[model samples]
Target: MRIFALPLVVLASFVASAAAEYSCAGPDARTQPPTGAIVVDPTGAYSGSFHNLSEAVSNVPNTTDEHTIFLFPGVYREQVLISRLNGPLVLQGYTCNTKLYAANEVTISHAKAQRDISPEITSGRNDLTSTLRLKTNDVKVYNLNVANTAGRFLENGQAVATIIEGNNYGFYACNFTSHQDTVYANKGRELFA
Candidate 1:
């Protein structure tokens, strides 16, 4: 009888993967807002914090410096549009467990549909029906919940949780809650986990 030997690389790869722990924001979630970041705290617990996410996003300078936005615990009712920025953007939400999206303390919600055209949108657009719209590249969002409350209706049509028209987007430990079309992305590089 002949004995066959397995490759050493195969065994090493198995051991490395077995020891690896799956986590979006590492093992522990963020408790404190990062320095120099625009913080959004609707509860007013943090001094100088913006009351809403839209205001905080607008406050970001259009410079090629790395920027981060930390969100405190609260439900924010707004339609946010993150446009082109010169720098990389990071949106981090407060969470006790970074491993789970359900542990997120911050949620951005809006009830809108393509059928409902506004002044900004003269015609019905699939992208406009999204609760959160990202049109820029090099963006990473973590531990946040985005929801579209628009349900099944003949007039309401399909509702989207998020629309990513940007080139590069990475969403980690995030929850996109919607009955129809949870996410719609253009022809770009995107990742969701």
Candidate 2:
């Protein structure tokens, strides 16, 4: 009998790829939003101020205004970098159960590898390669699905789903899925439920 061992990194990548292959068989079931919740619909069918998630995040003033962003059912493909938020911020996703991440219908994803960086940029950390990077304090994310679609067959380096680099941040009922570096809580006080 012959036995061959695979590296842990390779094994992890295989598992991630296997999970990625699994998809929803049909269209996502619709659910009514919470009363008075701001809605963001990609189809322009809803009364939303912005169509894209980045625009919604950008519309918010940098001051401590304390705002909440409600994302409707959709697969948003973009790299979202939130920085210098002096006040409280809440990003909510459409879900049947607010306390359970399994019912989340919103997915924010992006495909970016570490090797695609330019030479001018130094300190090429995984934060720069994240799909969603939050650099503000007092941030709360609820019932949201954040993913990095960079795939698991990369030649080098890692991809991240969410980079938490702020103080007093809380993530509740959120599903974070990625091949590598799914959730990087590097600094400050944070809570994940």
Candidate 3:
């Protein structure tokens, strides 16, 4: 019994240490933009334009500090996940209504049916989760519309437009449009729209 207990205690300690090492602190905040102008077009490369939002976010100097990504006016049809590990990130759209259209779409009846059913049934629904999942703090998105337009399918439940799980996150002049769970503001305390 003593030998078994010793091994269990050691395993528990190791697990705790590993969990503690994982942190959500973002890189040093920057007061200025990292690049002159970062454009994201479906038909361009690194010259200044990016083919996707993730590429633009990936090009940001993760180790150098905070930075900004200026996205040109276009309908970005992809799920954007902003991680907190990459320093302070600012996604600025060229136009006031630059839309980030999530591929997932949810209708009114579909949303109602899911709510009436078991939560587990809805848990398997990725479209109902969020089109944009934010895992970073101090991140701001300006003049953009994040949405999940994937209507009911046999595969899942409802669709979520945006999921905010970061602290001190701000959405300025941005629209989060969806049916149910339009914005899942979870865990993190500080959030502003």
Best by lDDT: 1
Q: Candidate 1 deviates by what RMSD?
A: 9.3
TM-score of each: 0.81, 0.77, 0.60
Record all residue pairs in model 1 with backbone atoms less than 3 Å apart, i.e. clashing. Answer: none
The TM-score that candidate 1 achieves is 0.81
User: Per-residue lDDT tens digits of candidate 3, residues 65-138?
Assistant: 55777655456777776776556767765541223222111111112224334666634344335677778877
Model 3 stretches astray by more than 4 angstroms: 1-37, 96-128, 152-156
Query: If both were scored by TM-score, which would come out higher, candidate 2 or candidate 3?
Result: 2
Which residue pairs show collisions in model 3? 84-136, 104-148, 104-149, 104-150, 105-149, 105-150, 105-151, 127-159, 128-158, 128-159
Q: Write the per-residue lDDT of candidate 2 for residues 1-193, one digit (tens) a residue.
A: 1233457667888998876544333234235545544567788887654687898888777666687788888899999988887679888887766656887889999887676666577784688889899988899888789998777736745788999888998888888888877888999999989
Clashes of 3: 10
Ranking by lDDT: 1, 2, 3
lDDT of each: 0.86, 0.79, 0.58
Q: Which ten-residue region of model 1 has the weakest summed lDDT?
A: 1-10
